[model samples]
Target: MTAFVLVAGAYTGDWVWHDVAAQLRAAGAGAHAAVLTGMGSGAPAAPPGTDLERHVRELVELVDEIGDPEVVLVGHDYGIHPVLGAAGRRPGRITRVVHVDTPLVQDGATALALVPDPAVHQALAEGPAHLPPPASREAWQRWGSTDGLDDATLGRLIREAAPQPPATLTQPLRLTAAATELPLTGVLCIANGSSIATVQSLVELGDPRFQALADPRITYLELATGHWPMLSAPDGLAEVLLASAKGEGRRVTRPAEGELPPHLRPFLLDLPERRRERVGRVDLYPPEADGPRPAVLFVHGGPVPAGVEPTPRDWPTLVGYARYAAGLGVVGATLDHRLHDLSAYPRAAEDLAAAVDLVRADPRVDPDRIALWFLSAGGLLCAEWIAEPPPWLRCVAAAYPILAPLPNWGPFEPRFRPAAALGRAGNRPPIVLLRVGGERAEIASTVEAFLAAAEGTAADVEVIDLPGGTHGFETTDRSEDARRAVERTMRAVLDRLES
Candidate 1:
């Protein structure tokens, strides 16, 4: 049987993995949950001084006891540190490593480095070694991403949680090149607000805490649930974990049109014919017209790592935009570029070029009248095309895109700098900016800078400020304000394409 070892975060014990362990066992695997030195019934009187080495040693010992030549190490939250450290020590015995909503710490770095804020770090550091459960059931529900926990599960969880050692949070991780060589997967819980947006910013900033994820061997898996998937989404988490262990998590397979949300069903159409093999896939939405018709390529913003495969849940907004374009009598295709961290940059541009070529060659598409609609990070790919317009490329639309990079996230690439390219471009296709009113300060500033750069350009530029709409307003926010912005932006794009 396959051996699976599970580790829980600080202030928690093996009980947190009860459901996942059970699921693993039923799937014909030998599952074991490691109870750290100062946790649970293992040693109630043990002080909170249990440090990193103890936890790593305990994990290594557990693997030895399992008597398996290899095992998959699954860690939740802070558990990632010890699990990674143990894996480094016994690289040959660790077949795979999985981190659930926890960033990997750099060698000689404390896991607390992953905390986004220093205040949170201070709180965790000064707290009692074995932190107590939330004061009341209501507070527990209100705590970070635990709102999804049912009453029964919450009760069991409250009873089982033990105060963790403060040393565990204080100790730094010690890992070498060996840890990076292990097959790694990150299961991000989106409901906790740990979305792709957060990961993108981290990777762009070159944050050391996320270095492991940025490596070529790591695959990203997303769960749209809360922080603790074991209690909130055990079955789903189990399926992903099993897939990771079987080394299938990185394989890319296009989602069937039927598998998409009901609202996206009507816009489905066959892909454009290609002479040679294509670099990426596109979800086509042909217009209702019989003869050739004007078409638009819809690109969604994502800093999906270079080699990692994007799951269906990864880009739902792109589907919404493609369908919206089709509704306006324009053929639309949503393209998925190479997303791995190793291949995303210049590769995305190549993919976009290939997509444009495919659409131009399609008999159903009007090659000379094609337009480009880019959203978020997708705008980065448009710098070159916009700077040097193709005779057939019509207009270009950028919706709440980060036209420039933030200090935290440096430039994507020198050529991918949209703001710089805007100033250098001569007369080209008309450009439209769909500015969101409620965008975050940093991103909004970048958009503002781009708008400023476009002011003196020879190209005809238009900016429509979408009032009361936040970032991703079209797909994520369902308010009347968001609805109006979507309608206005689509109308703007349609007018430009027809003009």
Candidate 2:
């Protein structure tokens, strides 16, 4: 029987781990998760003046009672400090310790004292009192992930926060356990991810934690959710940690060296980072199901760097493109490109070319069955990449493509007025350019310029003139046109492949 010991973080108590713990117990693991004093598990927190030495001790006492010399102890968030302290003191007791996106203390320290920020100290002073009232009773809910709690469990959450005793964080200890080699698992929770700046603000001292995990030996799992991994991705979280404990399945070896995980997320595609050196590191999306598939190199317009993994919002994602390619087998990917700004050019086009290189290099992506799915400014960049003509690319499908930016920059424009932004249309790629157009004459002019450039240049140009469609016709909040757009894009890409 694998004995389990669980601990909660911050104001949360054992309540958070109820779902996960039950599952572990059922798996024949002797699971025992306890509430910290002044925390959850039905214990009220100590007053601010509670003795640090006496209170922090409850952890060791609890472990000793568990009777298991070797236990898998889980320390979530602030709970890590006490759990590790107890683990270090009784090395024989803790077989393994799992930190779910918890902070790694530089010097063994407690939560409050380690904060190091006066703003936090001030916030702690005003503390839970000054916090805004939750919109509903569920506001006080202890979260493992958004998915962790159902209606019954959520209704039972305690409304008030436990008083944080600063002594826990201030007293640093030397971890004598040479067994520090005990496995550490990190859950990278990216959902509801605010800017990196915001993440740093909360765990300012956690910079070293990120640096340490670059080693492959450390078991790190990424759940495509938010900071509250247990809430949004409870199953994903449980699956990773519990699975890690059981033993990781043989990860099918891929040719590409792994990347900056959290920063990249899911945009990971199947390509060696070295091949597209100019593009730096990219996230490739491989086909999810077992089937040969038509492929597309997706380009999205963003001044900020796109992450490596696909986010939930990246709907009709790389995998979606692969899955929906007119029942034709399709593997797809999107790439991150460096950019100064939107109005800026040349840089975006350069990044698109790098994406093309990535697609061509991926073994699973049928080299000749690939297309370009570009939106808005991305369409402009795609047009530019086509000019260079990566050997593998076969077709292009652009959505609200930006062309002749100077002349036909808006809803109104004459159809043949030199395409406002066609300054260098002649230098573009010779592949087929499939444009989904609207009623706007500027789009017409843009199409005309693209057509004129391809007139005898061997670049096949096809236009789907959407009746009464506007610049952002199908991309709006899923109107009938949006449905049609998805269907049309799917049909067109498939037709190109099937033909």
Candidate 3:
């Protein structure tokens, strides 16, 4: 299907993306663009209660009219939901969404809502009336203007700019796709030339919320052009649009069903069931069919409050999600974990060891290829596993993991050491993240915030910004940044696993 656009933000219309649209067509994509209700590129202002329907209609109409197997959807500014709503209404028709510097408003939120800038949000509401306004001048001065555009181009943009409808600004979109799954990419364009780049949270897509999109699949990109890259860096913007259509923009690995254990399948897709009194659970996968492959028994990212065992879906990077595990073709499996109340330190590690014993009990799993993917508490548990180190677990991949609250891995990173790790050589060389005073920032809170505010201010070279938020948020919808952070870390893990 054709590439579609829903112009959002600043009471603008589809005309704004004209420069981008042209480049996309040149790049071999059939593209269509729509102006949302209330704001028009040239049309006079409309009446009240005009919702995002115009934008949605433009998208849906293009999809329906094309009759293609699937289409690539693009949204600029605040068009995320309008396009997403249209996509959700007809999920099968849209192959993927290109969130081109688009604010992904799911339910009633604008891109402006993400940052704490109310004044700009208000200006945005007044629609065309407020804009080309005094405030925008500063933003424009700082980030707008094309080095190559002439007076004619400038006059047309200034004259036709429409005020954004207050209704569109106020109406919260109900992100229907939250329940259904879809792939989306949010390109963070520092159009204003702001040193920092962002997607502006439908509040921060970090670990939790994004895990819904899963990793190695949902793409994220940042561009150097000012906000209206379409007007200035049209060529570059068009390149990105073409990449979106091709599905080769950003590649990620997801789990394939072939790697899953025969018994694990029903349990993975099934609802909570009576898990027999098993010591622990070990998950696995290999590269090819019926072949021995490297497997990981990721025993981390603690479980939720409701149950004793971790539902694969509950964890931030819910283990055994076929879409996720299939990536890298790594055999990704996790035990039905027991987190809070019914759990303690040694008990979990012992159970893990037994679980490994069980896997070793099977002929399919290559014990030599086993690795431990430990998160936070699980990291410490993995340290215990290494004390005597189970014969099965060959390597350890510790993520934002807590390896005995060392004096270093703390400030905000909890360092409480479990008694089980007492007197043990806790120097396990796992691929670790937030170890307090960490060399690299774990994609966790505090760290991500630090990165956000300290845009250029130099801090500790060892002090990195962890967008992933503290370890726990990795697999949950709680933090979108954390999800990307975890995915980045996953690549590293894959590299290490292969090495």
Error of 1 at 363 (Å): 52
**Alpha carbon lDDT at 169, candidate 2:** 46
**Residue-level lDDT tens digits of model 3 in 1-499:** 4554535445456787777777767766666666445555554456655655655665566567775465777766566657777877778877787776544454655544442234555566556433342234333332232333455755565666665555454556556744136676656554232211112211122324423333444676556654556665778777766666566554333345455312123311222322222333544433333655556666754422333223543343544332244355656566755553223544555667676666555565565656666655465565454444444455655555534322112121122232233234243323334322222222223234423433343221122235434323333322445445555555655554566
Comparing 1 and 2 on TM-score, the stronger one: 1
Best by TM-score: 1
Q: Cα-based RMSD of the predictions, in order?
A: 14.4, 16.8, 15.6
Measured on C-alpha atoms, candidate 3 has an lDDT of: 0.49
- The per-prediction tally of clashing pairs is 13, 42, 60
In Å, residue 54's CA in model 1 sits off its true spot by: 1.0
Ranking by lDDT: 1, 2, 3
Q: What TM-score does each of the candidates earn?
A: 0.52, 0.44, 0.44
1 versus 3: better lDDT goes to: 1
**The 10-residue segment with the lowest total lDDT in model 2:** 407-416
Please, what are the lDDT tens digits per residue for candidate 1 over residues 429-465?
Answer: 8887888887755467667777777775656777878
In model 3, which runs have C-alpha deviations exceeding 4 angstroms? 6-8, 42-44, 67-69, 103-112, 120-136, 139-159, 178-180, 190-214, 251-499
